[model samples]
Target: MAGDSSFDQDKNKLAEYETSSSGSYKSSRGCFNSKTGELMGRNFFSWIKLLSFFFIFCGVMSTLFGLCMGIFFQTLDYYIPKLKIEDSMIGSNPGLGYRPAGGLGFKTINGDYKGLSIYSSLIWFRHGGDGNFDRLRENLDKFLEEYEPGFFANQGASLTKCDFESKPKLTDESCEFNKEWLSDQGADIKCISAEHYGYYYGKPCILIKLNRIYDWFPDPYDINEVRNHSTMPLSLKNDIEKIYEEKCDDDPNKYCPYLNMVWLHCDGEDDPDKENLGLVSYTPFRGFPGYFFPYRNQRGYLSPVVMVQLKNPTPAVLMNLECTAWARNIRHNRLKREGLVHFELLMD
Candidate 1:
C-alpha cells in the first residue's frame, strides 16, 4: 500500500506540471504573458524605450530639414527676383497691356461677352451723349487711381524720375504720374479724365503700358535705329524724330529718357480698319519712359502711361485697333502678342 501511494503522488505531480506548462505556453502567445507580465510580446519598459527612440529620431530629422530650408531662403531678397532677364518667365521681351481691362468688355465676336474671366481685350462703348461712355470712364478711373500722385506717396513708397540717356540706372525718386499731365489747352484737350477720357467728344482715350518684367529695362532707339528700322510706321518714325530733334538731338549718344521714351504706335489692324479709323493723338508722351524699368518691384512704382485719343473715328463702324510698344529689347511677335495689344473699338 505504501508503494501504490508513492506512484499516485508522482503521477499527480506530473499532471500538475503539464497543466502549468500549457498555461505558460498560452500566456506567452497572448496579450499578456503570465511569467513576464508583458503586453503584445513586449514589456512596458521595452515599449517605452522603442517609442522614445522613434520620437527622437523624427525630431532630429525634422529640425535638420527646417534649418536647411531657413538657411536657403535667407539668401534671397523678397523684393528682388532670383531669376531675371532671359531667365525670367517674362523673358527678355516685355508684354503690352491696356487699361479698363480688368474684366471682359462687351464683345460681339459670335460669342457672348458675359463671362468675367479671361484676356479682357475688348473696349466697346458709345461715343456720344446717349452712349455708354460712363462705363468706360469708370473703368478708366479705377485703372488710373493707382497712377495718381498721392497713391504711392501715401503708402510711403516712392519712384524716381529716370531718363533714357543712361542705361539701366534707377534713381530713388518716385516718378509719380499726375492727372494734370493729360490736360491740354487745345481742342485735343478732350483727352483729360474730367472730360470722361474724351468718350464724350467722340474722341475716346486709350491708356497703354508695358507689362512689368523683373530687373528688365528697355533699351531705347537711337536716331539711327529708329530711322533705319525696317517695319516702323512712317508716321511713328517721323513723330519720334521730331521729338528727338526738339529734345535731345544735340547729343548723338546721350538720349533724354523722358523724351527718349519707348515709342508707341497705334493704327488699324487691317486695311479696312485703317480706313475706318480716324485721326489719333498721343497725349503727354508717345511711349513709356525708359527710366521706369528694370523693375525692382519697388513699392508704389507707377509704370509710365501713354494716353491715346481717337478723334473722329467713322461712326458706327467696328475697328480693330492694334497698339505696339517699341524698344530694342521688346520683340514684336504678333502671334504671341508680345510687345503688343489688340482691342476692338466702335462708337455709335
Candidate 2:
C-alpha cells in the first residue's frame, strides 16, 4: 500500500512536468497549443490591432486628398473668367433688378408667369388707387436706400427731419429729378414723378435703375459702330442722328457720346413691326436713355437713375427688355459674358 501511494505521487509529478515543458516550448517557438488555446487568442488580437491601424491610415490619407482637391479647384475658379451660362467664375455677373418688386403695396395684376417666361415678366400693374402715390414714394425710398444710399446725400439733397423713434421722411429735394446739368444741355428729364409730370399722360411709374459695378467703362469703338451700323433701321438711324444733333451736336467731346443704351424688344415671335422699329425707340419713352455716362474708375461717381412710366398698353401684353452695357471687353455670348440685364414688363 505504501509503494502504491508513492508510485501514484511520482506519476502525478511526471505529468505536471510534461505539461510545463509543453507550454514553455509552445511560447518559445511561437506555435499554437491546442490544450490551452492561449496562442490562438493572442494571434486573433494581433490581427485585430493590425487591421485597426490599416483602416486608420487609410482614413487619414483620404481626408488629406479631399482637402487638397477642394483647394485646387477653388484656386482654378478664381483665375478663370466665368462663363455666364455656366456661372462658374470667381465673381458672378452682377444682376439687374427692379424695386417695389414683390413687396407690400405692390400687387401682381395677373397670375404668376412661370419658367423661362418669368425672367421676361418682371412688372405687373393695377388701376391707380388710394395710397398709390404714397406707396410709390415709400418703394422709391427703399430702392435708393438699398442701391444708392449716398446718391441723394452726395447730390446735396437733404432728408426731412424726424424724431429718432419715427421713420424719417424723404423730401422732394432727395427724391425729385434734379438733372440740372442734363437740363442745361437741353436733355429732357422727362421721367420725374407722374404727379410732377402730369399723371394724365400715363400711370405713376417705378424707377428702373442699374446696380452699381465699379470701374466699368464702355468700349468707344463698339458704341460708334453699333450706333452707325448700316444694318440699323432707317427710322432708328434718323433717331440716333437726331439725338446726336440735339444732345451732343455732333461733338465727340460733349455729353457721354458713347451712351450705354438699353434696348427693349417684344418677346413674341409674330410682332415683326414692333421688332423692326430698331433699337432707338426701345429706350423707355421716359426712362433710361440710349446711352449713359462712361464710368472710367471715377471716384464717388453716382450712376444715373432711370424712371419708367409706361403708356397704357393693350392689356396683358408682356414686354421683353434687355439693358446691355456696350463695352469692348464686355461680351454678350450665351456661354461667357457680362454686361446685360434682362427683365419683363407686363401691363394689365
Candidate 1 lDDT at 91 equals 84
Assess each prediction's global lDDT (C-alpha) against the native.
Answer: 0.75, 0.42
Off by over 4 Å in 2: 1-95, 103-121, 130-137, 145-190, 193-206, 221-224, 227-237, 247-301, 333-338
**All candidates: TM-score:** 0.73, 0.43
Candidate 1 Cα RMSD (Å) = 9.2
Candidate 1 structure lDDT? 0.75
Note the residue pairs that clash in candidate 2: 120-344, 259-291, 260-291, 260-292, 261-290
158-204 per-residue lDDT for model 2 (tens digits): 32222212332322222223333111122232334334321223343
Q: Write the per-residue lDDT of candidate 1 for residues 52-166, one digit (tens) a residue.
A: 9999999999999999999999999887778887886768887788866644445568875443335556676776668766767777788878866666555444544445454
Against the true structure, whose lDDT is highest? 1
Decoy 1 TM-score against native: 0.73
